[model samples]
Target chain A: MQSIGIDDILDMESRKRAAFINCLSGAKATNLIGTQDKQGRTNLSIMSSAFHVGATPPLMGLIIRPDPVPRHTLHNILETGYYTLNHVNQDILSAAHQTSARYDKDESEFGATGLTSQFVANIPAPFVAESAIKLGLKLVHHQELAVNKTHLVIGEIQTVLLPEDAVADDGHLAITEHGSVAVTGLDTYHELQPIARFKYAKVGQPVELLGE
Target chain B: MQSIGIDDILDMESRKRAAFINCLSGAKATNLIGTQDKQGRTNLSIMSSAFHVGATPPLMGLIIRPDPVPRHTLHNILETGYYTLNHVNQDILSAAHQTSARYDKDESEFGATGLTSQFVANIPAPFVAESAIKLGLKLVHHQELAVNKTHLVIGEIQTVLLPEDAVADDGHLAITEHGSVAVTGLDTYHELQPIARFKYAKVGQPVELLGE
Candidate 1:
């Protein structure tokens, strides 16, 4: 094994360092966060930082990097207090990646990337029509970490839209059945091949492998 | 499409709700977080909430769920101010999953799970010898989120250990080549099959797919 210290990472060039550090998080959840401005212009942006915050209240969290430019997703979420998280599947991942491109506030990524904006009667935020699993969330907490000035935005899951058969009797969503993809580092995307699902861990019991 | 609202989710059985809500994070970075007590008794716990906090300072964050029982990993990290994040690979994933089993404070999960513990001169925490990618980090920030009482621990990467041949010219680690796996929901593990690596998004530019 090759060992590298913090000094070595600090001495590396910025872009190289970004790639190196980004890979440390391993495979990330790739989602397109959907939102819309007060004037009803929609916004869609790619987010890999979304993670499970709490399951009881169904809280979800996304890490918003310190931005030098305007972030329409963040802006719209602030303006409307609502947003959507749509899974990026194999078919639409390229268009989903394009949502990361910066665009004018008036130019929606949906139009620019050729993805469709989907809306329901109750939620103002748009969900990606191509997404197999869609979640509508309401902003619940926003905080700027005093340590790094980056933002942590948390939302409560208010609505979920998916194919009825996608969920199992035990409540596990067969996400890979719908072709939802996973990400490695900043640019690489990968489809998931089920390995195994183990039974819940118990101290002295024999482990069991639950099929995918 | 089936549309389920918050009321439906709230009305779910506790076990069902846990599984259902856990899938919202999509695929996660499956890691075994290693830490040790002041007395040097080791601990290893499976965590899927590990996410990149920043690359500039090489910061990483892990969501520590609100525990109904004592959390040895959190206790040791707070005690020693250092921990290691070890990527769970295919060969040792079953053992990695076994680390989640509850054991007494003095008994090391490494010994219990049959995974070997490795040590370095400067760090107190143990690293899983079976893990191909290992990162030693120092706790930089710890906060109990006011909204859900869940704890968030942010650490600065201090040491990284990996195979030299695994890194690319662009600094991305070929983790899948080394058999590192990703997770969906809580217990399901998936091996990554590369689809494509796209270039940085640019407005109005043709998208390019770079093969893995």
Candidate 2:
């Protein structure tokens, strides 16, 4: 294994290093399009760096910067504790991408992007009507990482929405049948195809060559 | 708003419905993945369904179930107070998914999947060499979420490893370049892509609109 000194590591700039680490970390390839409220008005942001945290209570999380500068969605969710995670497919990818714009507070990205909002049950937040799959989240905790200027928004899932046909009997979801595109690195996006699925097996013991 | 009875809401068997509503109520999706002992014997489970309990010390967490399930990653890190977040990517997506299996103590998924191991300074546990990015972490606090069922593993990042080219001049990471994937519901994976980048702007309210 190649060993490098910690002093050599700290020399790298934070943001520049964050971008590089994000790529190698495989977290750069996300498209977690979301809609949140600002005083009852809605705003959208396309977050592509989200992943699962647990499954028992079914939790999920994503990191958000303080707008790189305080934005509406961050403000709304933190204050009200509610938001929606809408999946971006080929149909809404462009509009979903456009949702990342720096629009004014009264502005609605749903209106600007031409995506429809579907009201979730008992929640004021609306899900993207165009999303292939959408998950509603309630903010349980928020933390600012001192190591980096990033906000980790954690939520327990309340409702999960998926195209009926996409769900397999064995509980696997086939998202690609609907044609979803994922962010690969920084500027690139790619459509996904299922390579293979294997039975759940225990990890096997390593075989050692005895008479070599 | 379309109001549905709580009982009616509970009647839905769809994972989306449950995940969305439960999340909307207050849960945030966040976690940390941990590795095993000094010998790099075990690759444990994921943690931190509780995203941020504290910001001053930069705390992150994960909720892990007890054994008979064989979560080596969680056991090793908690015992040694060290682990690494091996960001899941397309290259090792299958292997990362496989790690969730109920493997035996003698088995090593790292070997089975052909993923290499690397070390970070001062941490006994090893990081995934094939990982596009890895964060070396030190356990800050470990607590039980509920009785006898789950655990909340919290940690502070001590060091980070990133690829050389993934960092950007403006401090933005183009992680999708490394082909990362995000999980949803219970066991579904999606690829990621970056469509566009937007400016982070501040918000202003009009008193006239709210009659303030």
Candidate 3:
């Protein structure tokens, strides 16, 4: 086994350190966050930091780095109070990744990446038309972390759109079945293969695999 | 496409809703968060919410559900200010998932699940001995969400331990190469297969896949 202390980690080159630290937590869900600026220009950016926050209210949270310069996604979400999270499937990986580039606030990533943006049922934000699973979220909370300048943005799920067959009878949406990709670090993509699904665990009993 | 509205989602049964909402976000990194209570009782619990928070200072955050009952993992981290996040590989997936079972405070998950507890440099918390990658973290900041009762616990990486072969020359860790598992919903586990790695994106330039 090899070990690295804090001092060693702090000394690595910035980009290398970023890659190391980002991949350390392992594979993350890849999504393109779509928000519309106050002037109604759409902005789409690749985000792997989004995580499920709760279930009852159907909340999700994503982390945004410090605003040294203007962050169009954060600005748009704040201005409109609504955004969409669109899962990045294999077909759109490159376009989704390209959205991370520092484009001007006036530039729309939808046009830049060649990904179609579609507005649904009067939602102010646009969803990536290529996404297999799309979520409409209304901003509910935002907190700036004092440790780092990153902000945690929480949103309540208002709508879900997906292919009917993607959802199972038990309510699990098989993501890989729809070709969605998981990401590691900043640029590596992974294909997911379901290994096993177990029933809810119980003390003093061995877990029963769902199909078994 | 089928669409589900907020009212429809809120009307579903709790467990089904949890499963549906959890899997909707896609694959998540699976980890065992290890902490020790003040009385020296070690607690290990499976967590899928861990996400990379930042890189310069090297921070990671995980969500802890509302503690209506005593959450041993949350209690221990709050009491001691230190915890370990250990990656769950295929070798230890069953044991790792078993840690989710409700066990008595005095009964260590390590003993119950047959996973070894390892202490490195007296970090106060234990790491899963079978894990190929482990991190020792010091709690830096914690915030309670008003929308949901969940708490976002942030930690700074103090020490990192990994197998020498797992890290690339450029600092990206090939987690799938280490057999770590990605999880979805409550009980589904997935094996990861690296698809592609691209260089950092730049506006107006096509991303160059690494090694292409």
Candidate 4:
């Protein structure tokens, strides 16, 4: 085996970058668009780095960078303990992406993006009406990553909004059929499509071998 | 606007459970299984739920359930100030998943899981040998997701390991080709193929135009 040092590890120019991008290439779930902070100040950002964390507590997480400028949402959430996570479906993918454009702290991305919002009880955050899955997130915890620039926000889902048709009879999420998008870094969208399905336990093994 | 209450949200039923199971359908990325305790007894669990939070501080997070019997890694991470986040590549996927099996407290999952252990300087946790990316994480905060059943553990990455070849000259991550796999709840793996690529600025847009 080749032994390498840390400095050596960091300095080498990579040869596999393109292939690496290709391998993990996925469409950003465009369904969740206009997420807002508790104090009612909002900023638009695009994300493809988001995914599920737990189900029993119905929890999910978002990794956010330090705001480019002072903003109310992050501060509001830290102080008020509530926020909303909205899905960006196909129709609103563009509007959702537009939210990420730098805006004045006092401006609402909802107005610029032209999306509607609703409120949940006990939670002060608002949900986007256009999303296929709307979640009222109760701020549970937040941690600053080592990079010193990102914060991992963990939220306990107090409530969820699902378009009845978006959930299949078997309880599997069919959000893509209604046009959910996936985000990569900040702004890239892909129309999600169901390539195949597998039993939960069948992971680690190939799908075809599992025999449906 | 159609109003819906949190009570109307469906509980975890068999079919609904399966719907969630199905959502893992094609999403795949390899994650480093982490095991650590307050006492500093660390084991490795290589699974992927690890996803990006946002780029501001550039955060990433993952989920872990109580051990099938008594939790060790999760328990240690909660008790101790730190744990290690390792990545599994195509090379270590089998070994990575094997770490999930039950083992005695002293029997390191690294031994059982077919992974080689390498520790980062000044940190107590270990990283996986085959991963293109590995991170050392410090427990920043956690919250009870369910009353007592599940706790969402959030950590800030204190150190990061990225393959020299996985990053582009432009500083963007080109990850898919490095052979990463993603998890649903547990035990599902899929090979990913990149269908397209986009500039960093265009990630979360509506699908109507992007898709066409």
Q: What tens-digit string does per-residue lDDT give for candidate 3 at A1-212?
A: 98888889999998889989998898899999999977888999999998999999999999999857789899899999999999999999989999989998778999998999989965799999999899999999987888888988999999999998776767788888888889988789999999988877778888778878
Return whichever of 2 and 3 wins on TM-score: 3
**lDDT, model 3, position A69:** 70
Give a tens-digit lDDT track for model 2, residues A1-212: 23323343455555444333333333222344455564578777777645555444556667676545457777888877888877667776656666666777778877777888788675667788777667777787677644555666767667666665554444444555655555533334455544343343245533222122
User: Which docking category, incorrect, acceptable, medium or high, applies to candidate 3?
Assistant: high
TM-score for the first chain of model 3? 0.97
> What's the lDDT for residue B14 in model 4?
45
- Tens digit of per-residue lDDT, candidate 4, span B109-180: 776655677776666777776776666667765655443355556565555566655555444554445554
Instruction: Give the per-residue lDDT of model 1 (tens digit) for A1-212.
Output: 89888998999999989899999879999999999989999999998999999987899999988889988888889899999999999999889998888889989999999999999747889999999899999999998877788889999999999987787888899799988999999999999999889998888775679752
In model 2, the runs with Cα more than 4 Å from the true position are A1-10, A27-39, A54-56, A140-152, A184-187, A203-212, B1-34, B38-70, B85-99, B106-122, B127-135, B140-212
lDDT of candidate 4 over A55-121, digit per residue (tens): 5445556665575676455666677777776666657656666665566666776776687766656
Compared with the true structure, all predictions reach lDDT values of: 0.90, 0.55, 0.90, 0.54
Per-residue lDDT over B1-212 for candidate 3, one digit per residue giving the tens place of the 0 to 100 score:
88888998999988779989998778799999999998889999999999989998999999999966689998899999999999999999888888899999989999999999999975899998999999999999887788888988999999999997776778899888888899988899999988889988899899789988
Provide the TM-score for each candidate, comma-separated: 0.98, 0.68, 0.98, 0.65
For every model in order, what is the iRMS?
Answer: 0.9, 7.2, 0.9, 6.6
DockQ of predictions, in order shown:
0.83, 0.17, 0.82, 0.18
Ranking by TM-score: 3, 1, 2, 4
Residue A179's lDDT in candidate 3: 88
Candidate 2 chain A, run of 10 with poorest lDDT:
A203-212
RMSD of each: 1.4, 8.2, 1.1, 6.7
